[model samples]
Target: MQDSPQQPGSTGPTGSTVTSVDDPWVPSALEQERAAYRSARTRRSALVATASTLAMLGAVVALVGSSPGWPRVKETFFSWGKAVDSFPAVLDGLWLNIRVMLVCAVLIAILGLTLAVMRTVRGPVAFPLRLFATAYVDLFRGLPLLLVLFLLGFGAPALQLSGVPNSALFWGGCALVLSYSAYVAEVFRAGIESVHPSQRAAARSLGLSYGQTLRHVVLPQAVRRVVPALMNDLVSLQKDSGLIAVLGVIDAIRAAQIETASDFNYTPYVVAGALFVCLTIPMARFTDWVARRQGFHGAGGHL
Candidate 1:
């Protein structure tokens, strides 16, 4: 059997079955002019932006090049030969930073979410949990991350407990997880509380328990709401992972330090920095893209 043809009056060109394409709507001259004007305006704005950016960059380059210590600065910090020599080692060390960031990110998310839930729990019975969460957040959020790293990385190893590993790397990671989780817990809590109370009531009305409502209804929305914030924290984690180097972990910055010690040239440090920029810029852009796509911006239209 052959399929029937689509009648012209049955389906319009726009694919609406209620109308025919026999009389198609056309843009008026005013609408056509408006569209052309918009296109031209966009092109002009882009051109101006490009020219201004290039001019600003050129000015900065000229200023730097004309500095009194330009040659010395260039030789010490931007030598192509040194960069080439350090690239492999720096890249290898950066892998450690990446791994640390990945592991710490996962641990941060888990601990942070747990803390958020703990803080948000109801009832007098859960007051202890709320107090503990509040105290933990206040303590860590007030302390500088570097100090925490120093205390844990140096002090933990000094204690020499039999069952515990005293490695600086382990303690450094613990410090990172502890410090970062506090900030991330606030982000999670903000997201969770931003959720309207009506949602919980609705879920409960449908016979869901509090835990079921949180897991299925509240959390999904909360997590989605704070995704950009979480991603920003992850980006911060990537850069801050280098701080583990101060604990003697041989991460990218530490490797750069050792390389710099060989000849006192800072080019290896610059190389390490460039590699981190390479790592961070993409993630930063991706976070912005996620933010835009989520419709927080006017561009995404309240998605």
Candidate 2:
């Protein structure tokens, strides 16, 4: 028998009725959108991961090449196995550097403090004091420290200035103190000036003397402001102490040079370099800490 005609709302094949032509079997709009988003995110994540891996690999390669060599470098740089057995010889020169630096630093600090005070003082005597300080600073700062050291160590004998003969240690140390004192004086002056003007005003308003105001109120803040600068200068001074070797005052560098001359190897210089780095690193870190404490973020702030 022939099939009957279907009605408008009748079920078709599989007993399912279509609602609209827009509905299709492939996917929903929201599902399609979600799939597209996932694919984009996956692609972006893969690209980023690849870039990061490349960067890390490059850094590793760079570090590997930069290192002189491992076992060979250890032997060449430190010579800890055989060369370090001669510890007394190495330490002798190190001790000399320590002594000279300590003595010169003490002298420099005293002289620098005096010069800084004189620079900031007011009166007829103060003017001459300030002028002398200015000239000294300009002279020392303009001259090469090595040349000045040479002149002081060799030339001072002809002048016949009392009991001050041209002894290497004495003259070399004097030159170092003289050069460093000028710089340290400026550091001290900056530290003093960094104190708020209102502090002095308040002290004067309260009937405190100028000396009292500076001693009690101004110097403290100045010290805090100058600590980082002072620490940095100390580090520089430590490095500069090596210059004393030129005056025949055997420091670490000079000792290394003597060893290199005997052994015909550059290992001693490497050793000296390492020693200097060891001295300077802690000082640099301390300066960094002080700077951070004072709310300085290097030369520029990131955020």
Candidate 3:
């Protein structure tokens, strides 16, 4: 029997099935491209993740197994006698550290504020001020902290200058102020620049003086923007205080070194490490808190 005539719009020889339209299996060019892109991305991501994992594992193994010193460090920690008896010296050193940090922070703020303002000032009248500030910042920032301390300590006596006393405490504190002020000056400058230029324009339009505008409008906002970064820099400054040991400052590390020298045991150094962590942890936490409070913006909002 002859087959029934094909219905209108049905798939038959006269009505060729347009594969692009009729076949659900066929995909559009754009959709196919997107699918291929997704597949490639997923495969690439997998490969990268696997490689990273392997690298991390290798690093961990190398750090734990290949290093010869970690066992001795661990053993030192296990022995309580050496660390326990040196606790008094460590506490005294920590006290000195607190005093040094406090004094240096104050000096840095004063000096850095002066330098930052000088550098940003306008006109030929302030040319020497700008140059002086620039030279001071560049010189102190370039020199190593230990060398700076040595000059301030040993060289000062020859010059009949008593800025840094015979006490290492005096020299270490001065060194910190000198070194960190340069860095903080840069921070302050960035903060000042971050203020919108229009604010100054608006202030000028209102017949405000340059100083007045900066003091009232610009500086307030800029300081808020830079608080988080300032906190980070302060934390870094605290860690670098360890370099003061070169000046014979009996800071935590230096005290530990003395104890190590006397007893031939490395336990005191471990204690010093722990003390450094104790001192630094608060600063670290403060930085995190400040950053969060500032809405996690980039340093000076440049991000």
Instruction: Note each model's CA RMSD in angstroms.
Output: 5.9, 14.2, 9.5
TM-score of each: 0.89, 0.70, 0.72
- Please, what are the lDDT tens digits per residue for candidate 1 over residues 105-129? 9999999999999999999999999
Clashes of 3: 0
For candidate 1, give the lDDT.
Answer: 0.93
TM-score of predicted structure 2: 0.70
What TM-score should be assigned to candidate 3? 0.72
Q: What are the runs in model 1 whose C-alpha is more than 4 Å off?
A: 1-20, 23-25, 296-303
**Which residue pairs clash in candidate 3?**
none
Q: Looking at candidate 1, what is the lDDT of residue 149? A: 98
Error of 2 at 92 (Å): 2.2
Best by lDDT: 1
Compute the lDDT of residue 249 as modeled in candidate 3.
75
Q: For residues 235-258, could you state the per-residue lDDT of candidate 2 as single tens digits?
A: 888889889889887788888878
lDDT of 3 by residue, 1-303 (tens): 999866545787766843334445668899999999999999999999999999999999888766888778666554589889887897788777777777787788888877888898889999999999999999988998878888886665566555535666676677789889998898888888877789899999999999999888877887787787788877777777777788777887788888888868888888878888887898899888878867746444432
**Candidate 2, pairs of clashing residues:** none
Which run of 10 residues does model 3 get worst, by summed lDDT? 17-26
